[model samples]
Target: MKIAGFDIGGANTDLAIIDFDQGGDIENIKTDFRYLPMWMKNEELGGYLLDLIGEEIDQLDAVGVSMTAELVDAYETKKDGVLDIVKKVEDTFDIPVAYVGLSGMMNASQAISDPLQVAAANWIATSQIASIMSQNCILVDVGSTTTDIIPIKNGLECARGRSDFERLGTGELAYTGTLRTNVAAIVDKVPFDEGWFRVSSELFAISADVHHVLGNITTEEYSCDTPDSAGKEKEDSLRRISRVLCGDLDLLSTSDIESIGDYIYAQQSLKISEAISEVAEREFLDEVITTGLGRNILAARAVEMAGLDFTGMDEFLTPEECVVAPAVGTAIMMEDYLSDE
Candidate 1:
């Protein structure tokens, strides 16, 4: 069976195409993601979906979807956004389509009936991999815009919070992520030049800039728009990061800028670490399974910082596959749903 799964978020839409043997074992998997700012082009989603599918459109047996794009500012309410996105998927293909909801996979009719059931539920699809990977662990997926930390035990997702709102209170959701998070959201002050320099709340730079300067991700991997709309080169990142201190290159030396990047990186890791600690302690889970774009750079580092056992999803799937694990999981899940039917 061939299945395509899409994880649509506010910033990026990730696609996973999986081919399964008759025995239901994955034969091969291909994944890719595009930066589609839904706020500006929510109407063009159908085109983006078709572009991702490309030639595979003729071969796909089914398409599964999980989305967080409903929470984007493109719509006045989550319900409205959900309806619009669902319509696009429904209109885009004649093949079988299902939406990944909080309760496993929902048919297109069910999704349209209760849109909130599927709104911002991409994390749940990603968490399904835990039962196959480990018996007791927390699944931490750090994407470009947000991090999903879900607890699973004895082959079941045992998250205390079902919604993003509830997850935030349970420490299962941390708003900061690898690329798009504002640097100011991570820290208010940085220690430099023998004094603590407070950062500007202005959108001078994003986590991508700091990660670029720190060499965590490549310039090409900085898929989100740069804060200053400048080049994604290291120097451009350095200059933008300097603005976090309310200054430019002329005011901050290279060493000073590197220091700021280091601090921001540490704090970002610490944020995830603290959340991991809280969730791990509350759930009695001692190991972490990290995946997604920031899985290695941020999630693994945060796992170490939280003083827990760490397992990168790359161990089971290639790093490329792990980067889009949610979509992969959603595809596998849809395949299962269809087979059962």
Candidate 2:
């Protein structure tokens, strides 16, 4: 059987194709993640999603979807966003479409009726798959825009909350991310010239700039639209980071900009570490299953700083699968559901 899984977000759309035999073993998997920026192109999302899947849509036996795009400013409310996304999937695909949510797979009708359960529920699908690998582990997924600190126990999802708001309250979600997060949000002040100064709260530079300057992500991996709308060149990254201090490259030396990057990266790692500590206090998990684009650089360091064992997603999946685990999990869950029927 062939299944196509999609994780649609405000900034990016991720798709995973899973081929499974009758015995439920995965034969092959392919993943594609694109920077669609749905907020600006909401009207054209249907076409974009179709283009993302391409020829694979014709051979799919089932489709499963999870989304965080509802929170984007393009939609007035999450319900409207969910309904619109579901409609687009229905219009694009001929086969059955399952919307993966905290409660599990739901048909388009069920999903539309209970949109609240489906909004921003991609983490549940990823956590469900992670639980199958290790029961007593925290799933720390540091994606492009947010971090999910999910606690799994006894091979079951033990997250303290379901909704994004509830998850934020319980420390299961952190708005800080490795790519799109603003540097100012990561640190209020940074070290420069043997003195500490408050950073400009403007949208000067994002976390991508910090990682790029620190060499955590290559120039190509800095995929998001830059704050200055400039190129992703190393010098361009430095200039953007310098703007965080309300200065230009001429005013701040390369060493000075790198120092700021180091401090912000450390602070972002500490942010994840603090959340890990909070989830650990309630769950007693000693190991973390890290996934997402920042898994190696940010997630691993945060787990180490928090005194927890780190398990890279590559241990369980290929490098391609590691970054798109949620989409793959959605397909995996759908296969299991279909097999049971």
Q: Which parts of model 2 have CA positions greater than 4 angstroms off?
A: none
Candidate 1 ranges with C-alpha deviation above 4 Å = none
Which candidate number has the best lDDT? 1
The digit string of per-residue lDDT tens for model 1 on 141-179 reads 998888999999988888888889899999999999999
The residue-level lDDT of candidate 2 at 108 comes to 89
Residue 251 in candidate 2, Cα distance off native in Å: 0.7
Residue 36 of model 2 has an lDDT of 81
TM per prediction? 0.99, 0.98
- Give me the overall lDDT of model 1: 0.91
Deviation from truth (RMSD, Å), model 1: 0.8
Lowest-sum lDDT 10-residue window in model 2? 41-50
lDDT of 2 by residue, 139-191 (tens): 99999999999999899888988899999999899888889998888989998
Report lDDT (Cα) of residue 214, candidate 1.
84
